[model samples]
Target: MNTKDMRDLDDAELADHIKTVRRDLFGLRFQHATGELENTAGLKTGKRDLARALTIAHERGIDTNK
Candidate 1:
């Protein structure tokens, strides 16, 4: 996902997307370990997406310290 796409999601939606992305990341890791993942580049994309979402969330000032 791009920054513009990430910005369109509300906090709740972003949070949910983060969870889903994390689950996907876990699966990707398993596939990589088993040499079943055909696209290794996807791992980096997922990580970047997760970081983008978190950065957008933080910029929204949602009191992450809590």
Candidate 2:
């Protein structure tokens, strides 16, 4: 997801989107550990995306529940 897209989201949507990205990252990590993941670059991408979401959440002062 691009920052432009994230910019369009309301605070609630931003929080939800962060949660979704984090979930995807968790799954990706699991797949990587099992040696079942293709596109290893996705792990990096997922981390970056999760970071983007987190930055947005922080900037918006959204209460991210850990």
Global lDDT of each candidate: 0.86, 0.89
lDDT of 1 by residue, 1-66 (tens): 899988998888888888888889999999999999999999999999888887887888754332
Give Cα distance to truth, residue 50, candidate 1, Å: 0.6
* Candidate maximizing lDDT: 2
Candidate 2 residue lDDT tens string, 1-66: 999899899988898898898899999999999999998999999999888888888888888885
lDDT of 1: 0.86
Identify the runs in model 2 with alpha carbons over 4 angstroms from their true place: none
Worst 10 residues of 1 by lDDT: 57-66
Count: clashes, candidate 2: 0
Candidate 2 colliding pairs = none
